[model samples]
Target: MLRELPRIFVNIAGYRDTELPWTIKDLFEKARHPERVFAGICRQYAPGEDDDAAPDGVFAEQCRVYDVHAKDSLGVCWARHQTQKLWRGEEYAFQIDSHMRFVVDWDEVLLDMLGECDSARPVLTTYPVPYTPPDKLDSPVLPVMFARFFDNDDIVSFGSRISLPEDAPEKPQPSAFVAAGFLFGPSKLIADVPYDPRIYFQGEETNLAVRLWTHGWDFFTPNKVVCYHDFSKRPERPRHWEDKVDWRRLNTVSKTRLHHLLGMEKNGDPEALKGIENFGLGARRTLAEYEAFSGIDYKRRLINGKPGRIADLPAGSPERKADRKRRFTFIKESNGWGCEETASGGGSTMAQTEAIRRDLPGVFDSLNIRILGDAGCGDLNWISHITGGLQAYLGFDIVDSLINEAREKFYDRRNHFFSQVDIVIDALPECDAIICRDCLTHLDHQEILPALKLFKESGSRYLFATTHFLGKNTEIKTGGWFPIDLTAAPFNLPKPLITISEEAPNSTKSLGAWKISDLL
Candidate 1:
């Protein structure tokens, strides 16, 4: 049964010029049995010459890397093809991007979830609610959602509810298909049900969801194990609406193709796809400006060698490096976590409440508790509650009340709060061990060294964090600020403390525990 457990396969379709994120590298490091996981690099349509390079360093240690060459038109199709060619006999299969941040034993969780499923069932996922959302429409946010296709009303209340039926056959219906990051049945299921090659851009997953529903295959959601994409950073607004319009047009075309193929047009009426047509005027305006200003030759560029899409770049270019640095510092100072001087402030009170709540008996049994920053009276309340004695203290800044308040209103207080790198670091307490649950990648490159220094000074014998490498190419934001090119770099932080465990899935409640003496 153990041997038959599905191998973890990561599909990086456009990871050619893009460096894997540190969070992903951490996954490789934390894997309980790294050998069991397999990483497949789909470099098929990268415009430039074949670098044929393997992700170097630790990732190279335990992963079987494959470089598959294909084209953008066959993006998802190629990925599905590779899954079939490899991992055919595994117990379960998962598809995730190279930038996902994880805090638990994902493999075991996936295996357990797959085991719970009847072999005949299908599994899909929704985007992990971002740890943070942008303040406004023009903020530097990741375009994680294809807002064009999703009905705002439908997504507003979307939560643990599995809108798609578990046993419903593949049929055309109003379904909110969980796109991009998700796990499904055995690799053979996807291999047999390959993504429609006709989809040149997005909407493939939506189409697949519809197809699966029509086929009577059931879908499942664990609602427990959770992971997040690197969508915390927002992008600058495009100078011209045409850039936005052109992308919207392309999205429209994809959606049109999907609707037509699915026979979603009512009474054979083409107007059923009117939602797509309505956006035409706006799309045309944006495209016109985009073509005139950017001079983008869509055809030649269609086959162009840009490693990943333009959207992957940071908000600004080289000139904005200083601004990025300033923002990073501001984020660290404002939203990061820290110990309260007194338990009187709202921060202290909140910490006290969480510490008291989480310290319940048997709570720390499976979970590890390491507080960063200073050990304040409020933080000590939590330390005393959790079973394992305060193990480590990795100091970071404190959370900004404004950000915390915004988070509370917008996100689930339980999951989203801790996911915030800025907030978590701010609330850290002094201890012997440091536990960073996929929180390190959000730090600026410059802050990493100082943060590490603080961790070392906090009397912490062990430090747990994640990192990725920096790629050569860079992205620029419209605001004229350019942060480090994260997509191009994989994380590269050294583990000074005891290497207790490799990658293991963690519960949304708690990740794992570490002994302070282990590092000594």
Candidate 2:
């Protein structure tokens, strides 16, 4: 049985009957998880007017609701409720907007995540918003959305879209930062770092995050965990309110204040505080005050440590540029055709050329010949058509009526002929060399393994083939095969003696080749 750990205490603020998508009663009915204990502090506009009915109906006698509202007592009431919850020794606490929905098994996710960290460390989690992108508006209501900005517990950087680094491993890593809407941490941590009442709304998270980061708290976001927020469900307001309040300005102010408190601003120069200013109000003030308090001159620091601009740094620094260079070399070596218009297309053509080129030197030196698939409309067969004097044979699979008619009318049966194409282990011919270009990608995954096995058993001394490497979100085309595995192996049998080239081509006809033997 899974261990029943400490329960999660959720503090939902600003939740009202009309503001919620459905009544809070309906929301909790779906959230009736046995492991979690629910408690709500609903503020009422009038005294002795109990709003406890909502929690009573939703929790079904499982939780408690307190009506702590009085005249001008909103902030104090929330503070008191938070204090009381902490006093009760709740293990984990979250302050959330009422409209957010829980999609995943939070208990299992949190348990698995927390187990990966030290017990002494703090826990902070953010929900993924599912409805941010306009394109998704037409789709079914998804439970998660992609965040465009980068988030860290200490600092929130907006505007830039997130992407994996070029050198990133196959799997994604934990993010260094995250937003606060769905923040999480140990109950004691929250108790120790109480929200500063001075912050009405804007800079509260910024201030808290700066303090946490300064104190050496490790912060991260799980790559896969997600949640959805109902941004559209917020209370309606009067027109021109956006211009009057200038929420963006408020954000700038809070960010500036937090930066100031964290001592991030050292000098009067604005560049040091640019990120904050760009974010909005609290940011500028925070940096200004932080500079004043820390007595760290920003101008002096800037002069002492001049960070290089991104453009000035060597291309793709922090990762060796060799991989890209290797890819280019392979392209130039492989592609013999030069007709393509773009560098990438040209490179691809060259890569194909190089694959044949590598084997050419050995074959020419030995005065031996090789055979490739027949010269049909398929581009690869052109090699056999062009090399008139070379001892190369063309093998055609003319099953289609149109192709058979074209073949019969075109008068070239002397050099090329249709043959039975079989991929089983027993049907292939023993040869000194063979080539199968751009054919693997058309086979099914099931056919690939067996075909490779048969190729190995063909007794061919050398074989060459072109296959694809898997990329993100790539799908198999209808009636086409996706590669089973890209790695060279006994699975990719009858492996060629010569190096396979995978490079960008320059054109339709000229594939450059570099002998790996030359590198030796």
Candidate 3:
């Protein structure tokens, strides 16, 4: 960074090591202006090593080295605190690991690239394509463009990259996983979402992502390569987990802190909650909104654009289903998820809710009802009529735009509320009866069964779902009401009460109803 930029101050946080000053001395002399570069280092000295071991010279003018007693070493967080305390409020900042190499003009290019962002508060990061075998510096690899997710024992998520894009754009791609090794953004933003001293290391990235996103900060990957990380010397470097203590036990404690902040560990995890009490969420959005926007359901550790839960992918050969998310494919080909509903189109919801209010008093007046894949409360008023006498009512949908609109237009928080989509993975609050509209038909067959099983497991004694199964032989057209067989694989609903021949509501062309006991 010093070689590339004329006025960049470097913060080299060293813990349990004595080589930081020696390393900074070399870089300080090589930098364009030695006075501009400030090194805030936390060094642990050997027993006989002198505190002023760093030779006083021109480079010493810009160094603020801390003598953290070697015997007092606790974790990397303590070292980080010492390093960050040297902050004098610069405009922009870049946090990187000690072992890394940079491309030519990286600093200048990165600063200019920040101007290409679409958001007022943008953070630039990525798992930069590897640059290995120092001798083979010319070998080119593109930055990770696409994000793929996998769960980490419900602790957090793991991200993998798709093949590099052939034709890359000049601007950075918006990213959800904040690469801790390489992050570039405004100094205040970093200060706002600073590292938590309680968390050692395992869950720092996730914690940063949640805090930044909720604070209305957006993240993106630099289309151009800013720098490359050298992974060859990981063992040679000092790590927080290297101490003699039970690191595994510490990691378990860290996971609890992560789950609590994400709102996943609801029952208990008070210790975790207290760890993050000082670092609160920003005013821009909620964690659920962040999950919906990024398409990474933290509760489920699943992502968008993959054949995962809640992704309504199509039925075909594995070739078509591979690496594709149902919602992305549909929205790409058509206007959007074909589930948009207005008052006129959702007339059936009125009829259905009224029937429940009139025909099923014992169930409607006392039981809690959860409507999955509730597109929009097109029948909000009518549904409220039935739910008014009921114990409670909750509606959830995948399309967040519709959910947000419906939540604002109708439903009081005291009794009736709607939330984000979590169909196939995260368990919903238990309900007495689940009133699912024609939503099953929208899911990939692989997801339908798990979804049904999850709904049944929600303590729902009765299931009144209107989605249907195709007959023995039939070709189904997608993007509208299509052939979705709920009885096919995992879910074998005995048979519908009666296959309603009547034309269905907006999201679907036709539909039917099924009961919970029938499915069992």
- What does candidate 1's lDDT look like per residue over 185-273, in tens digits? 55644544555443434555545554554444445544343455555432221111112224334444555556454334333335434
Point to the candidate with the largest TM-score.
Answer: 3
lDDT of 2 by residue, 1-520 (tens): 2145566665554423333223244335444354464444443223334243234454545444454433333332233344335334667765555445553465455545665654355555544454422213212221221212112112322211333334323322233333455665566655555554323343354455444443444454544343455555222311111222343343344445554555554443353344443223232224444324323223233211332222122333321123222222323223312335322233235444565555555554453544433312233333443444444444532123223443464445454434434342224566444455444444334334555555556565545455433221123421233443333342432222443344435412211221212211
Better of 2 and 3 by TM-score: 3
TM-score order of candidates, best first?
Answer: 3, 2, 1
User: Which numbered prediction scores highest in lDDT against the true structure?
Assistant: 3
Question: Which 10 consecutive residues of model 3 have the lowest summed lDDT?
Answer: 471-480
All candidates' TM-scores? 0.38, 0.39, 0.51
lDDT of each: 0.39, 0.40, 0.56
lDDT of 3 by residue, 1-520 (tens): 5445434445555554333444454445444345555666666544465344343454676666676665565455546656677767656666654444565555566677888998899888876555453323434455663334332234343454544445667677777768776777776775777676666565677787888989888998777766555555333334444432454455566667777778777755566456576676777889888888777676665667353431233333232233223332323223232223433134344554454445444444443333322322333545555555455567765544445666776646566677765465546666666666555555545545567777767765566665444533132222234555555444556666544343434423233445555666
Off by more than 4 A, model 2: 1-4, 15-32, 40-56, 60-87, 117-120, 131-178, 233-260, 264-520
TM-score of structure candidate 3: 0.51
Error of 3 at 291 (Å): 0.8
Using lDDT, rank the candidates from best to worst: 3, 2, 1
**Candidate 3 segments exceeding 4 Å error:** 1-9, 15-35, 44-58, 69-71, 129-138, 145-148, 160-166, 233-238, 267-272, 305-520
Tell me the spans in candidate 1 whose CA falls farther than 4 Å from its real position.
Answer: 1-6, 15-23, 44-54, 57-88, 122-124, 129-176, 233-253, 265-520
Better of 1 and 3 by lDDT: 3
